[model samples]
Target: MKQFLILISFLFVYYSTAGIEQAPPNFKVRDKQAVFVDFRRAQYNITFDVQNHRALVETKILFEQKQKGYPLFDLVNRPLSVTIHDKEVEVSLIKTPGDASKLRMIEKELPKGIHQVIIHSEIENGTRFSTNDRKPDWGNVSSGFFIRDLRDRMFLEKYLPTNYEYDQYRMEIDVKVTGTKRWHSLFTNGEKTKVSENHYRVRYPDFYTASSLYFHLVPINRFVRYYLTYPSIDGRDIPVTIYSNYRFYNYLAKKKAWKVMRELEADYGAYPHDQLIIYGTGLRGGMEHAGATETSIVSLGHELFHFYFAKGVHPANGNSGWLDEALASWRDKGYQTVDLPFYDSANLAAHNLYTRKTDKRSYEYGRSFMGYLDKQLKEIGKPGLKDFLRVFFAKRKLTTVTTEDFKSDLEEYAQMSFQADFFQYIYGGHMPPESGHKHVDHDHGGEENPHHPARTEAEMLSIL
Candidate 1:
């Protein structure tokens, strides 16, 4: 009996301690900091079973180990199974500290090299899209059925097992979806290739891995689709399409879009993508995506302009949201000649750029800061926003830009220092001095130094 107990202890020590020693030296993790891996790409095959209120999904991810250590994948919800390097492995789904979403990481140690991982899971089609009667409408305000609606909705959480919001994994993807017989139409960001009657494939060369995969699955009766070609400045035909419910609204929206596209082309060279698709939503305003945008007539111009600033040259990460927002709001000519209200001591530079909570400040302060850029450009006797955009887009299109990168570009273009302006107005969160007001003199290139007028709250309300 004593010999049996001694044998069990000896085996435990061998398997726990000596077994780990047999791993590669890089895998001998002393602490969490030693783990370093770069996620490369992810591929997804999904079967959307709306009738069953669930989806069966399989995802494969490719990653490279920068050093000898384990890599962690930000996976939300429970997964049926997780595998590393083609082998099923045990994984812990501990709640990540300081996160409210109950997100967990699938962590595994690996040797220093490239590897492929897979996750298979079944997800519930939650009641987020259900009506009071318990019928799923998918936000079909137009009386349509859409599987992946982007009406301020999050399909990523339900369908994808991914990392946290800030860790953006930019990668190419090949996606296939089946079981769409009930839906009338489906629209995705990639080029559509039909495989079977109800099965389809979409291919993306470089998808914004960190962002949500937006899909619009709508009933046929809800949308009016059309195609038209506009002449580019370089004499090439640009194919444009619009999907919406109202014919009159689509007509007017197309007109505005064409004008904006032309203006953007002239300023920023050619549009980067092969074609542009605009999806109309019952929801007010719009959101931008690569090669496409979702919008309404009220915000057609603003959202369309994002193709150049936001989608064309994406902001580097969450902390750089102001870069694109500032440019987009600046391009929004609707705000140029109005009663430009002042921010209530709110500055965009000092604000955390990641969360959606800062959107209001990002727009208000970002627009004001961009206005400051116009002032600086004019001070050097240079043409203002248009010329600056021409240069910026030429240099940074189809890429990501950081705040520091934008500042450097502005400094280079103006041929004057912007160190103080960046620090005070952007980094320090200080409102621009009164000198940046529209009332400042420009005809004689001289400053009036006049006291700026402050309207009463009632006047502000009336103007708004």
Candidate 2:
């Protein structure tokens, strides 16, 4: 009896430590399952047993299967059970190479037609902020700061399993959270309804190809809020919330975000989302979600711009990520001079923007080219980049964009060849500067361009 109990305890500990690994290249490939299976919706019913430091989760996935194929599911290590089309089936857990703890689901010989998959599981969250290798620290807040948001916790996928890009299938989600923890306030990227005492539900429409869904359970009693309406853009009033106790947290964030929104709106038509929530804690850098972005006030504008570029006009793959990063970083520097200091034959050819590798030269060098392009457009008596973006966002709204899409649009707008310029900078060749300056060698530009007066130290402060 003692030996059996110990064995069970060891197995439980093993599985608990094993988390989901990063998806591999092959996982991105459209298998026969992807072609035959049309994913419809996912309904998540969750109960956060906070006292126990765990969540009991049940998720139902509805899909139409066109032909016989094996569908893949990304469960966190392992699921307690999975039922497909009302039939109980055995599931095999395949260990990933890079991360042994991470897992992928493989089921054999699924039949064609409408099918439903239900997953039952429990996810442990108490260690999210600890030194646990499997859990990230995003859920942790400072002593006075408390964030119990669904983003780091109650998202259904974290408990169950799904593809990396689940939002690509045009799937809607309904999430319900029930918890006895009264210290937290709940908010999600969905329509909210209180079902019962301590029980709440949120419904989301097709969330415009959201990469992930998030909800916040902030601890503060109340935070400063600001409301602004851009009637020319959307009928909805944009509500900006600062989930921080610091003085002027709301004012500084609202001011910076509003400035960026108006600037981008003038160039790109309307801002992409309805509401904006800014968290003043637990952010190393910043992140852009469907309708919200979390960052300090210093990076408030840059993160908000991601709504239009990264979230609005998404990259098709890692190779094209430069599109969003370059544009945002370029705008971050207040759109300074067109002459980029970091351009050469070696760096250009050695590393093109189309590779999946992360080298951040794409941000600096790539952004300089955008500035250069804007300058070139101005010189040719054509509309500047702001005009170009107005058309780009209008046409490619809510769609994944590729580099080719950008090139084709620029060509039509400029009425001149642009690929030659791309070859020089983007494809790894020398783009001789029109000012008779050598392209292969130039001074590395300062982080902030001298032409644009630098932001004052006080203005850069996030909290006061």
Candidate 3:
């Protein structure tokens, strides 16, 4: 009995540590900024002063140098000070390949092995507050911060020092809001502990990437919040929170969220996150932020579906982003299957290394491509794409994936080669023609995709 117990303990420890030792599929040695160091953990201490309309942040990062190379991290906001290995270091800005914006690069080269760095910075709070409107002006903030880094170059680096999406690391945040009499509420996907009024400590899982965080802070009175517990099929009673500025959406949002959760769990195996948070904007579109989403009433299902694909099985880069969007859009359109061959020519997954924007065509054209693939899969005496997605999610949840990884997995499941189809449809921009259908013309620019239009910075300042 004693020997058997010891063996079980040894196996548990081995399996737990094995995942940490293996790098994620997204970690590429060719990525210029990420090649030098391996990010392991990050801790951020943030303080918001509502009266002054300013935010102060201190970040401590733990990383290891793979070789003797300079280290760099992305941060749009300039830092007031930086320290490496407990020594003050000078930093400079340099542009990486395909990225117009520059990253903060450490001045000195570091030898191989682990290292620690600290950074302090300040940002003028973009959210504004006004007392003149009784309609609950979106611009008026009692005191808070909202962060959603969905677009290219808009990761956590926009406000604090952080690594790129290719790196997965644990994150801890200490948030304190002051200079306001109104109460504030915190919304996040991480494990949250309320230390006191207006103070919180959040810790994220180690498997999270740069894009996996969704942090929102707002005044309690500014919005209506509803809470419920979902009895998940996996036996975890998941907590659900829905909030909106409008009072009328409280009941409707809760109902719709419940329905969406049920449908997603039925299609997939289970809800991947510990909790589900929704912010019904009552607008046209929405953004999927890990387990939390700021979405419109109509787009709620689409965004929630993302928690399983886009957020749960994360995209490693902009180039591979179409898979999740296409999958969600396909599901939204009732999972239609088409026998007609698609002649469309769009390189939805062809982007440079530093490019950070998902192709806009992933919504319209990408959905059609999925339908075509589903039809093909069914015709080959195999289960439909839906079944494959369920299996894929079960296998790949909590990990980052590339388009190639997705294709390889699909091929392995179907026991067939999809190389020609992917090369023509996704990468090479040439699809077999379908009779009687006119080829649609599309602008192939790398700018923000119009399908999932997000609020402008000015609009976000007003709304957040």
Candidate 4:
């Protein structure tokens, strides 16, 4: 524990008591055990700094915990070779040599009380980027590594530090990385911040790491001022930040994303987040991490909505991911629903809809399902669907959520009560009866479904 505390201090040089601003409550839940981690990594031109089989490296670590003395690290899986001043220290905890970002040092024991931890790694010959890939045309949304040239590498960390959900980890990663001049700027959350000539600390205290895992029960959420957000049609103050090693592609697309975000919010719910960012990657399809949404050059808006539906509502568990995707896809021409359905991400494949399928798990399926729900909802009133969302979440506030919880929520809504017949839809596997409105026993107070598509979604505030 003593060694762990010492390492944390050196890594976080700027560690102080001054608190950074936090997000408002709306899209997020506050828990006492939750805390944020601020990380920074700097890269420099080591050719001029290395001499006599040694490299002169300097690092700055900063950690600020609301409560202090948290169990920092036990050096279980971290890769490193450590030395303090001129003397070599005994190995036991946190040893980061070259790739500090990949270091997954878990603590064997928790600290006695709340405390902060920081550590710096001054490697021997300096770290190299050739181990990772870096390709220029690989697209900004790509999640894996890409190779630009012999000396340049575009590293995308899609499969590292495996966690149930990044939000559960509750740490912010700040990287101040510099590579070849041709590879210029670096991007993660928003705009790129330069630290030095070839060295920079490009880390944000907001990114939730544990949520990046591709699985269910993945805890991911956000906090924001719902009233201040812009609708999708009008877009919001969302920014498009591109962080790359080369200035040629290193740029900020702020206005562009603001346009798209408002347009999305106009149709969906209010855009949440102190800021919306389009993280550049090297993948064909982008993943929607809470707060930050990754977008490729082609499909941007559809994926961004996942922040609201997928991460905001569904946990990317199973079919629920499709619930958001299909609903977003049902709409046409941006925010214009055109009296159809709307979901996020992309549509489900043939295999996803039928074979090997369980519940609502595809864009095609979700649109079909939501379209059916829309008809059923018309009678029970818009509040029925809203109630369904609230009820489903209420059951599993801090635990897991299943498809049955969703089905049960809707069934009890006085609309689609899950009777013995509804069991067919749940287990025996039956798609929603086409045009659920034929049996409507109630009337909704709004414009006819076709003429005013927003009547249901926008009925509450029209301008939300």
Highest-TM-score candidate:
3
TM-score of each: 0.71, 0.69, 0.85, 0.44
Candidate 2 per-residue lDDT, tens place, 1-464, comes to 64354345334333221111211222322232322243455666766554344556687765554556665555553677888756766666543322212334546567665556787876543212112235422122111111111111112344445543323433333333323333435555556676653466766544333243545543325344444443435556666556656657766776776677777777777767656667654234555566666566766777778778877775543334557767887888787657543576223222222122222455677678889888888888977876787788888766666555677798888888887777667645653222123323322223432212233223222221
lDDT of 2 at 26: 28
Q: Model 1: what TM-score?
A: 0.71
lDDT of each: 0.52, 0.52, 0.71, 0.33
Point out where model 1 deviates above 4 Å: 1-31, 34-37, 90-104, 123-158, 161-184, 220-222, 334-359, 429-464
Candidate 1 on 277-390: residue-level lDDT in tens?
Answer: 777754555566666766667777776677777666755443355566666776664435222234333334433221211233455566777776676666679988568878
Error of 4 at 12 (Å): 16
* Distance from true location, Cα of 293 in model 3, Å: 0.4
Put the candidates in TM-score order, highest first: 3, 1, 2, 4
- Where model 3 places Cα greater than 4 Å from the true spot, the runs are 1-36, 99-101, 129-150, 429-451
- Tens digit of per-residue lDDT, candidate 4, span 165-249: 2122223333322222322233234333555533333333333322322211000121111112334433554443333223332
Give the Cα error of residue 222 in candidate 3, in Å.
2.0
Q: Residues 182-279, candidate 3: write the lDDT tens digits.
A: 55778888999999767899998766776778777777666788888888889999998888877678677778888988998998988999998888
State the displacement of the C-alpha of residue 289, model 3, in Å, after optimal TM-score superposition: 1.1
Give candidate 3's whole-model lDDT. Answer: 0.71
Rank the models by lDDT, top first. 3, 1, 2, 4
